[model samples]
Target: MKPNEKQVNIELTCTEIGGLWGIFIQESMNIRFLTYFMHHLQDEEIKPLTKVALEISEGRLDKIKQIFIKENFPVPRGFAEDDVNLSAPPLFHDIFSLSYIYMMNRLAMINFSYTASNNVRLDVLDFFTECIHTSTEMFGKVVKMMLSKGIYDRPPKMEYPKEIEFVQKGSFLTGIVGKKRPLNAIELSEIFFNIERNYFSVLVMLGFAQVIKDKKLKNHVIRGKTLSEQQIKFFNNLMMEEDLLGTVPVGMEVTDSTSSPFSDKLIFSMINVLNSVDISLISHAMSVSMRTDLTAQYSKIIAEVMLYSKDTFDIVVEKKWLEQPPLVTNRKKLLNSD
Candidate 1:
């Protein structure tokens, strides 16, 4: 290894730029989420987790913003002062807040893992690596805190197997006919995880629906809630048909107050961000699902969700609320310049 053979630090690749744009927006929104949680969190054990979350998001934002500037890219107009009203009363219970952070941190860790793997630039790689570490710590603390508080709903338990065996049955690939094979761990985990998100999604959309004043926005929220309910039914019934404990929604445990604690923009942005993740999650579930019926179900739902998410973007754009991310100049337009 010669001194001159050292790897050169290159400019940010398109993947890095695009991926960072996505992560930066998500991090910014999380900052807003943490701020609200910090203001409303009552439990001493829970407040520390919010603080950890806040610190992680704030620090990561600084690094991401610096990279955007370094590469002459436009930093996204993510969540801002207008997004949250800290003076408002607590909209949800402390337990719900803790659970929210727990779920969000789990998602963030997965996000950073993917971003880190795809990154080529040293600084970008370094930034997302740090994010993965911080998110790991944050979720770890959140899980411990939730368990100690007796709010952690552990994933469904399964029987322990004594030995490993190779599959010889052709029934493994078929679910359209008699005697469908039981769900493997991969299929069950994905289905269960999706059910969990749908449960929380219903809670959030229901809250937003009750509080938001704009009729159009209110209608949109209502639709999202309905979609969540349908999806939950679809997934939960799959398990119920198998004679298993169906997915239980975490008791829509929100306050009765109709006053919104967040701006419409914030609500819409959050829904958009999470709905995007649902598409990816559903795709993953589809890939792992060997059963014909389950795979088709995933595909059908993905199309529905993808359409809904597109509508969300359309609304954001119509209201001029969509933030422009970094992009190369329009070369064709440039060629036409006088």
Candidate 2:
């Protein structure tokens, strides 16, 4: 293919990727609300925990929305009027909801890892990696809680560790000095920035979902609360590691009041911006392999969030609050002509 043709293909791929990412964001929002709505029946003891998880999911959702806007990409209508049941019976009990949260976090870790590794954009990779760390920590905490309640799942142990012996003819440098190095501050900062952006978005989504009347949706929001708090800490730590002040753009306010604080157009626009940011973060994380653990965690978080966001889209569609964007056909062909 010609250089121009190749460029068009690349652009098309990126656009598709961005759209796919948007789907994830929308689904995440849905999951957040579902968890929150389910937690309303719990006593005071479990209420706080549910609240924390809800916050985290909402915050991440907001970040994804901002990313799409920043990239000038169209954010898809994630949910439709047919997706939610405002009058349905409760879908999950309190303990079941908590277990679901734990499962979602674990899944998030896996997804973050995949994105961090595959994304070519350095900034995007970094962001996902940081998310991975945050999600992992959250998972750990949830697991602890499950253990305390004797509700945590336990798999059978393996027989033994797999081991291999290396040849002994290596030089001193080969044995110790030639190992892979740590990521530089610049690289770390890029990843950190990505994490900060994602966390901000998640918090925003959680705050917005708090007002949904459905018990399942409300429970999801509650679960996201703690995840958001943990993400903030992760971003702060990343900033400190890079010797820089931790700062991330807060997209928009999410409130529980019956009055809408912002127009539906504005909300979807912000979601687009957040999606762009997430892509950037994933790119950065991929540039440096030293942060593998972080990358893995973020991937998982993104995947789980995507599931929940889809649910939220359904809710928005049902309420007729979603704003439609101008549809664009295959623009790649036009790019090739020029």
Candidate 3:
């Protein structure tokens, strides 16, 4: 090899850049919430858990910053200390904080796994692989904490079938007609988790609605709460049809504090993220659901959530709170510019 040879490092692809940027923004927002929660946390049992979560988010942000710096890319201005008021009174209980950590870690695991699968760049792949591992570890810790505190909501258990069974009739696929069949294990599992997810959203929206100052934004959040309730009711009734009940996780409670702990922009961004994730979750649920009723109901829920998410996007744009993600070069526009 020639001593004068220089190594040509490959540049980041659009997907890799976008993934890191999105994760940076998300981690920044999460850091703010965790900081505030840490300030008000009273449960000694989960204090270390919350601290670990904060450390993980902060570490992720640092890694992203390093990557952007090395690549000579402009660092995104995500949420900051200014976006959260650490001195504000607690708007939710400690149990709710634990639940939030558990759910957020669950989401991080799902998203990071997908990002890892799509990116072939060595650095980006390694980063997401670490993210997946850390998120899974955090999720397990939160689950254990919830269980120890007697708040973990277990999914409904089915009785063991003594004999193997097969679908003998076409009624298994029919849900809207007379005398529909019972909910199968997979169908029941999907409905069960969706109910749990919406219930958490309902709690968060209720708290946000209470503290949001703008009448319009408050109303929008209230509408989100109502939508979550409606979705929960539908899932519950669907379960009742099979003579089974969906377990609603308890111990999450919002305080009476009307003061906002987060900036309006942060609040709306959080809502936007949650609603967008729900749309994806419900769509996936629809694909797995075999019963016509379940699929049809999931479709309707997706449509409603999509509309709600659109409003959130508009609000973020109108308020100039939306962060522009990385995009492909606009060759035509660049050529047209003076």
TM values, all candidates: 0.93, 0.43, 0.95
Stretches off by above 4 angstroms in model 2 are 1-23, 26-39, 80-87, 158-338
lDDT of 3 by residue, 1-338 (tens): 36554332678888888899999999999999999999999888878899999999999999999989989999999998899887788899989888889889988998998888888777778889999999999999999988998888888889988999887888778988867777778888888888888888998998899899899999999999999999999988877767776566575589999998999999999998899889988998899888898888999999999999999899899999999997788999999999
Error of 3 at 318 (Å): 0.4
Ranking by lDDT: 3, 1, 2
**TM-score pick, better of 1 and 2:** 1
Deviation of model 2 at 103, angstroms? 1.3
Error of 3 at 233 (Å): 0.6
RMSD after CA superposition, every candidate: 2.3, 16.8, 2.9
Better of 1 and 3 by lDDT: 3
Q: Write the per-residue lDDT of candidate 2 for residues 313-337, one digit (tens) a residue.
A: 6655675766554355778988888
In order, how many clashes per candidate? 0, 124, 0
Q: 2 or 3: which has the higher TM-score? A: 3
Error of 1 at 252 (Å): 3.4
